[model samples]
Target: MANKLSQLDQVFAALADPTRRAIVMRLCAGEASVGELADPFAMALPSFMKHIHVLETSGLVQSEKSGRVRTCRLSPDALLGAEDWFQQQRAIWEARLDRFEAYVMKLKKEKEQAAAKRPSRTARKKGS
Candidate 1:
């Protein structure tokens, strides 16, 4: 569990940067060279490299240097921790909603029971 949370932290931290997020999204298509990744952004090569470095440090992406070019690929497994956390959050919310629904139904039943036990409005008006 600790390991999972750590991974989640890293994933979230890495994705928090817009440039890093864009790099991840691009890698989703397949692998891309650092030069190719930088082409779409207006930032200088050195500045863009910093974003790639963050993604690499977070374990969200891995890069290989071949010849003079560095190619990066998305690491899908790194997202597992984040997905698990989201699933747990969703489950908790669903359970709370279900409990609320049951409580409402119980209250409705109690209301109906009380109405049945009470005298009719017409009978009360006649007596008054």
Candidate 2:
């Protein structure tokens, strides 16, 4: 569990930057050489490589060196852990909301029952 959380932390951190997110988004279509990936950005090559490094470290990307080029590909199932965590949170919140709705309904029913048992203003005036 701790390991999973740590990995998720890294993944989220890697994805926190718009640059890194864009890189990942591009990789989604297919693998690309380092040069191709770096071409679209205005930053220096070294600076761009740092973003790639972060993605590689987070297991969201994998790169291989061939001849003079480094090609990067999105790791298979890289986002699965984060997706699972989100699903778990969604289920928990939905359950809590369901319980809250039931509680509110119960309160409304009790209030209505109480009101039904009480005398109306017209009846009190008549009695007076």
Best by lDDT: 2
Candidate 2 lDDT = 0.95
Q: Which candidate's TM-score is highest?
A: 2
lDDT of 1 by residue, 2-85 (tens): 876777898899999888898899999999999999998999998888888889888999999999989999999989878888
Report the C-alpha lDDT of model 2 over 8-45, residue by residue, as the tens digit: 99999999999999999999999999999999999999
Estimated TM-score per prediction? 0.88, 0.91
**Residue 13 of candidate 1: its Cα lDDT?**
95
Error of 1 at 67 (Å): 1.4
TM-score of 1: 0.88
Clash tally, candidates in order: 0, 0
